[model samples]
Target: MNGNRFGRLFQVTTYGESHGEAMGVTVSGCPAGLELSEEDIQGDLDRRKPGQSMITTSRGEPDEVTINSGVQDGYTTGTPIGMVIQNKDARSGKYEPYVTAPRPSHGDFTYSAKFGTRNWGGGGRSSARETVNWVAAGAIAKKILATQDIEVKAHVNQIGDIEAPEVTWEEILEHSEENEVRCAHPETAEEMRDRIDEYQKEGDSIGGSIYFEARGVPRGLGAPRFDSFSARLGQAMMSVPAATSFEFGLGKEARQWTGKDRNEDWEFDENGDPTPVGNKHGGIQGGITTGQPIYGEVTLHAPTSIPKKQTTVDWETGEEKEIQVVGRHDPVLPPRGVPVVESMLQLTILDYMLLAGRINPDRLDGQVGEYQTDYHPRSPDNMKE
Candidate 1:
């Protein structure tokens, strides 16, 4: 319960369970007077909602988000924003059989061991259902970043062994949603879809990676050491269900290169601004944005609730048994995870921008920027006023 919160200035605390009555998020530190509505948040929710495509879980939840508070007359009030999505199609009965034998590669056993109890229905807090809140909060963060011309995008880069070809930002924006797999390449998207269908027939699941890019990010947005932007992004990605690994910019590939090949040389642009000749660092250096596109990838593990029987120990009887997981689950994760990844990046970047004081709080109220003419240092008396 204590670890439900995320971020420093722009914070989000998610609550509820997979089969619980409702799942929701409380977003705090959002600037006041920004335009907001249920529609703005619902658009992203619809993409992440279950049953939208054949490749995803068959559970038919509308996943409609309702704004409970924090906005008045279509604008934010700078208070904690509360939103909820009722779980309509949660089938708890299907999971009754697994109450004794915990599923392999799931949070059931560990959660029960840590908390002395667990929600057997749909893996409770461990379910990908928890990401609903994150997407909702991220939608709002996206709106905040839009004020500064920052945009975050993600696409399915690979599914099992099927990998998508290199795609540009425009291609990702224009074509990612054309298919269920969310790959930018049309042929690759179809192949990924066929692969998912093939695995779904065998009652199996597959995992893949997602590529994330943040464009138009200004410089000076990250702190040093502990709260580095990359560290925050990694922590956010790791918190998602089934997310196994994260790497940004040549990540593991950098291991093969020497220091000279790894270092990106700097040059002056036509505008007299310093720019990197090559973006080997993925647009980040010394824990701050480098005015280049920030890019990364998140690798997800295969969903554990396959239909085939698996060996496990019964928690109550202390006996070994084979259990066939029942109920609907995703055959692949990257497509749905694309929006989730983009949202987490938006949240982290917006929070860092706030902490860095790059964007003025009053900007939310239609004011562009606050300027000062005096250069005199502030004394304790001036600060008090």
Candidate 2:
């Protein structure tokens, strides 16, 4: 895809269809030798994998990742890294109903309009299955960012009408993984699960909010104007399939505040660094990091293809009909989306870090050895306007 390539540095180009042979990524400009392992990538993949919760699709796939190049003897070689994630849970038969009738709020119609044909099976590239590559690349980006002491974490903040309490970092880290909903607040997670269960019984799906934070990121990440880091982050986040809306910091809530309230009061730390009394800027100001925790939230729509019947039109017959989609789908996806959101942020962070000289020499200290590394391009740039 023309828009698949991302980054000014540490660029990642994702490829493959959702139900294609396999989906994978080609990462250019990653500093080699920062302790590479399948577990590092798999840890995140397992979370993003389906069949994890009562609320998610029942399709069983481990979403295992296999690294093919750019590392040797257990360290990076400062070369491009490539990895592949096989798709095993695809049920092409389930999509037969949609062959002639495009599902609403999905890419089927747009893809067919764009290409004259679409992969009706498993939502094609628009499927959340595509994010397996994003998570894998983010795992690699985490390795690249070890030097800056930067950390990115995300959790579900809301599901349907269930909302989480304002949570502390300690609580978020402790409780996010404690439940299938991945809500940072203990009580809210329970409520989210209950709501999802209720929706499942109705043969439907629900959407929710996923919030994220990046701490200790040095100042100056995103560029301003055309290259504003915030703008880039917004674009990158919105690229995730099924992503409905995204906001930085106070986000939509900021619009309700006047300039006097919207402004973050400044403070001087003992280290003499600029600090804001509140994170109204989401740790970013003037399109650069502000030495505060970078924060944002992603809003996702409920998955399409619910078992319950919905109305649609047949493209060939021009006759509207009722359709009950039969296929595996996550009844609640925001909780599982936590890693994908974090991955997008991580990829952006490392990319800008590379351009900013934070990851220069294209190498992390002690990560380079005599091991040979490999690099290959996924495809030529589309260059389509």
Candidate 3:
């Protein structure tokens, strides 16, 4: 009921449930004249839609997004952007058991404890299905960022220990849609898919990792001191329900290195470009973008529902019993999560770009570097080649 909103200047409030009649969002504060339509949002929706592969949930939602407002003649009017996705595959008959008893690793118990009620059908509001709004709102943000030459990408990096080969962001994007798992390496994605299949056959699930990168963003896209860009990213990721673990540039691996090995040293080029020799701090330092690609990773736990029956206590009687959540659920969430991660990146970077004045398509100043936000913390000494 509360806490469904995200963003500052470009805010969004998602409404609806996993089995609700309809789910949608109201996005406010976006600029006018941007090209937009249901078709624009539908492209990313198709990527995040369920029942795509053996690794995803069986629900066959086309996840088609319908634009209800904020656009006329394919351009935004600068008003609230409202869109909705109709629910056509909900089956509430499977939720009878959860009426009084709650499933483990779900919001059933917590919701009842806090609000005196909960929607146990397919986890009600706790379902990852809630991400539909994110993709919708982010689709707009991405369109805005593209004008500034900024690009955000995300891909499955590790699935049940099947790690992808190290590659550039371009390589990652090239390979992202090539495989069903959205990993850049074909061999690794094959192995990952095999592992997911193996677990699905056993009526179980597993966790995996996702990596995202933001490029071409002018420097000074973050607040220093407290509101570091990295912290904002963490907050965005922690919002995902099944997400259990995370790390960024070098993540916990940094713990294994000394200060000298961890510090990103700068090199100066003939053109005064700053080239970083290391990425020990992920991408942010002291709460600011260092004109380097922002790198981040999110770890997602396996879907909580399994066909296998489990034992639990009945809420009304406090008596022991067996219960199995029969909701249509994904075996593993990595493939579907790929688009979700990238969309959030668009939202995150778009906010900073707005603050840094890089998002204005008009370029009213007549040039890119003529604005106040154009100044990044770059010095001749710190310039790297």
| Top-TM-score structure, candidate number | 1
Model 3, 1-385: lDDT tens per residue? Answer: 6798987777888998888888899998787667677888898998999888777888878888888898776676668989999988988778878767877677778888888887767778887888988988888888888877888888898988788878788788788899888988888888998999999898888888888888876667788655778788888887877888767788888779898777767897566888677666666777787777788799998778887788777789889888766667888887889888888888888878766766553332235454322222243444657
TM-score of each: 0.94, 0.92, 0.91
> TM-score: which is higher, 2 or 3?
2
How should the candidates be ordered by lDDT, best one leading? 1, 2, 3
Query: Model 2: which residue pairs collide?
Result: 32-76, 32-78, 33-75, 33-76, 222-229, 223-228
Model 2, span 50-81: residue lDDT tens? 88877778888878888898777566666888
Candidate 1 lowest-lDDT run of ten: 370-379
Order of quality (TM-score): 1, 2, 3
What TM-score, to 2 decimals, does candidate 2 have? 0.92
